[model samples]
Target: LAKTKPIKRFNSPLRKAAALFKELHANNGSKIIARSTTQDRMTKSAEYFLAGFFGLEWPTNVTLLLAIEDSTGVWNNSLAGYYNCNNSNNYRSAGGNNATIEWYETYLADATARLQKLAPGFGWTPKDSYDAQSLCAYETVAYGYSQFCGLFTYEEWQGYEYSIDIQFAGNNAFQSPTGRAVGIGYVQEVLARLQHHTIDSPIAQINVTLDNNTATFPLDQSLNFDFSHDTNIMSILTAFGFTQFAQFLPSDRIVPHELVVSHLEPFAARLDIEIINAPAPVKASRNNTDLYEEGKATKYIHFILNQRTIPLHRSFPDCEERDDGWCELDIFLAVQSKSFEISQYDWACNGDYEAVPYGEVTNGVPTQTSS
Candidate 1:
């Protein structure tokens, strides 16, 4: 009998991602600025990621900034901004879970009865059916197999995906009152980094103490990595005025929209904002390869979310059309410069205001409260 080849361990997602970045900028971990929340999972993710990006001995190469994730304290942490913003923890943020509940009640009604009949004496509600569906996804991820996975039809799976979409739409995306407020800090930090300056003033959930210090928040680094929660990522997208996801989602039925939470913020989801420099203006050819256009060398900004290119032109009118889905850096900066004002962080998070109905506040702020 022939001997079988030894099985090799698969590369972790964090390591694979780090390896990709290493290819572009090798042995330059010292130049990178990385931060994560103080939570064990987040900090550990940072450790594993740094180890892959730098080396097994990554500690000597780079310093990982740990931000506090407390809600009651005055310390602001962009990675865990939801904890800092009171409104984010209030009923406002519950919109997502509320939306999911509404959706599951409608879609899982039939499934609940059908599954209950199969088990005879076991009573099952829509919540139980939804929990089972969730178990299918979680078990598949954890154990690589799940008996619950095959119980649902393709349409039911689509419904499940929509349920997730509605939850994010109402809770963290455009529909949430504190959506922009929760993510404005991270956006501010990114803008400060791009403009090569420290954040002089405290705004929203920005950690002023660290941001004011050059050592903790250096603006000179070309590469900045921040690890954060999935909900916060969605909030950041809304804060950046990605209006493509600003559409109103109905709880009763699936609607045609760009806001798909499963696709946008799946496990280990990543968003990369790249500053590309081309010798000349570039355009994508018929085959999607970049080709030089007639213009002087210029800097452009590209946004990639979960391996998909997000077209800046769709959100910002100032961003010129390009087949490559890139916006001129100057144009992009100008568009984002107004994000602080648009976010209305102070008013949205702390102002005395009544919450609007779910679909009424579709742009991340209450229209009646926002000035």
Candidate 2:
């Protein structure tokens, strides 16, 4: 019973996320569509966000959406699709578990042995090491400091952090070559909503259609909110071909300077995609001189990961070689649609690795070819 007390805070990171949302969508009267996995913490996360964004107490007018955590159920649960899918190529069926276990043993073996010797009778197992790290995080946030924190030195803590990264790399992100399949449904939904079309994937089973109806799906809403687990977020990022989250093995020695899960999947991580309207560039020729003019404004989409702008790789046809990863709205929809067309829910979830390689950006746009 290490977690004997509940951790409660009004000004948690979730509140900060709400503050950011309010700042970005101020005075717009935006209705939020909050969704989360069927976990208590995830559902409460949605509630906390509503309170902060609306500045209201409990029982606010906001509605929190939840679906059964099953891939094949009538309800839409893309978060759990990896677990429920019968795909032999999926993480569970693949070497995901073994890879993680192997990495843990390789990296944490010496430190765990030292911990067992330090705390005799504790019988430090891999689970205990993970729990100790979890307790350090929980108690640090909940009570400002944890006794478990004192058990490991600074280097051991770093190793512990790397251990979590290995677990995520092996079990979630790029678990197999087709590991990104788990998030295809969500990606499809994003494109469908942007295009104002009904969801085409049977795995999503989303009842609402993007028809400018504020009651169900609002096409004009300035912001949309979804609360999900770390794995789901990772899967979504991978589906977008974010190379930063690629799997790293123990042999890679990618520690101390690699992707740290603590920062990526912290207490309250956010993934934001902003749609902005801006004037299009117009090229004009006058008197043998080329003049560039700003044309009628059009919409564009950019991604924000943890409050930082994520540069879109230039392979996407619409993604120019600019620092800002803004892609024309129509082009973004078109690029994402390629993924939707190739994603076979049954095949992807059922371990058909040969169906089609996951699509990636190419020649400034997404192509059928896989990267």
Candidate 3:
């Protein structure tokens, strides 16, 4: 007890294995030994211990481990609306209103890393490739509900679009892979600004209803509140039992406003959700459609989302996509505008709700910075 010493006879892979072996053997269990007389060697705990303990990057280490783990571990075809990066043979395409190229790449990278670990030989790469032939191109550069401008190329100022779909709950099952009619309730676009255009201009005049901290969507299952058209707006509002939307119109940015819920349907689903300072797009569907596979409603809406741009840079535009749609959206007023505007691009909103995903400015008021 007087003199304690550090225990270090020798250190090695063999020693570590032997130590584990003795511990298990001494535990009084035959379960420790296998018929091969040797067990597969494993050192890292979850393969992430090293990264955390030594302050290394989990991404890089996990990637390396995946590279050496196995030739073919797994490829989950079960995930809906995901591009299968592992199988380069087919394009993993998602036909919806969304543009977040970097986000998809990051998602694919992490996913492929896991797949590679599960199945070592099966390599992974994003189908964000363009086919040499026009046959590869759908009838429209943008297909179904997909509003992708540069989906065919790697352009800087690419177009990103988003939308939401909602249908009667009864319509949940009426199509292949679950058939249901779908209508474009809402759509959004993000693209580079025009040559002389500033982020601001003649506002589009959107009447936002803020409840708690979020803007509201109409309740009607089938009201055409097309901001692009006037007559449609009143009908969309009337479909939701609103005596008058003008009364609930948000005057100040922080008015207690509530949007009436007109109908409930299973087809009312969120696509890519992004809670950014930018205007967040929301759902407003015309009909019901299958959730697993892209349907006409989503396809039609997606077809229109890619038409506009967010005006990122004069020459290089930054596009975005909310593949997973959203519900509660908040916004941090940048240069707090008197009011916000909504753009239909082509697919206008009727009774179905339509608004950008909402979020507020991160640091509060906008500040000026020199170039």
Candidate maximizing TM-score: 1
Candidate with better TM-score, 2 vs 3: 2
Q: Give the TM-score of candidate 2.
A: 0.74
Candidate 1 Cα outliers beyond 4 Å, as residue runs: 1-31, 120-122, 283-290, 293-295
* Model 2 agreement with the true structure over 13-67: per-residue lDDT tens digits: 8996555545555525534455666777877787788788666753444556575
Ranking by TM-score: 1, 2, 3
| Model 1 clashing residue pairs (backbone) | none
Model 3 accuracy (lDDT, Cα):
0.21
Flag the better candidate by lDDT, 1 or 3. Answer: 1
How do all models score by TM-score?
Answer: 0.88, 0.74, 0.16
**Candidate 3: tens digits of C-alpha lDDT, residues 174-259:** 10001110111111111101011222221111112111111122121111111111112222222211222212211112233222
**Which numbered prediction scores highest in lDDT against the true structure?**
1
Q: On residues 183-254, what C-alpha lDDT tens digit does candidate 1 reach at each position?
A: 888888888877778987878888889999888998666566789999999999999999988898899898
Off by over 4 Å in 3: 1-98, 126-371
Candidates 1 and 2: which is better by TM-score?
1
TM-score of 1: 0.88
Clashes of each: 0, 7, 61
Task: Report the candidate with higher lDDT, 2 versus 3.
Answer: 2
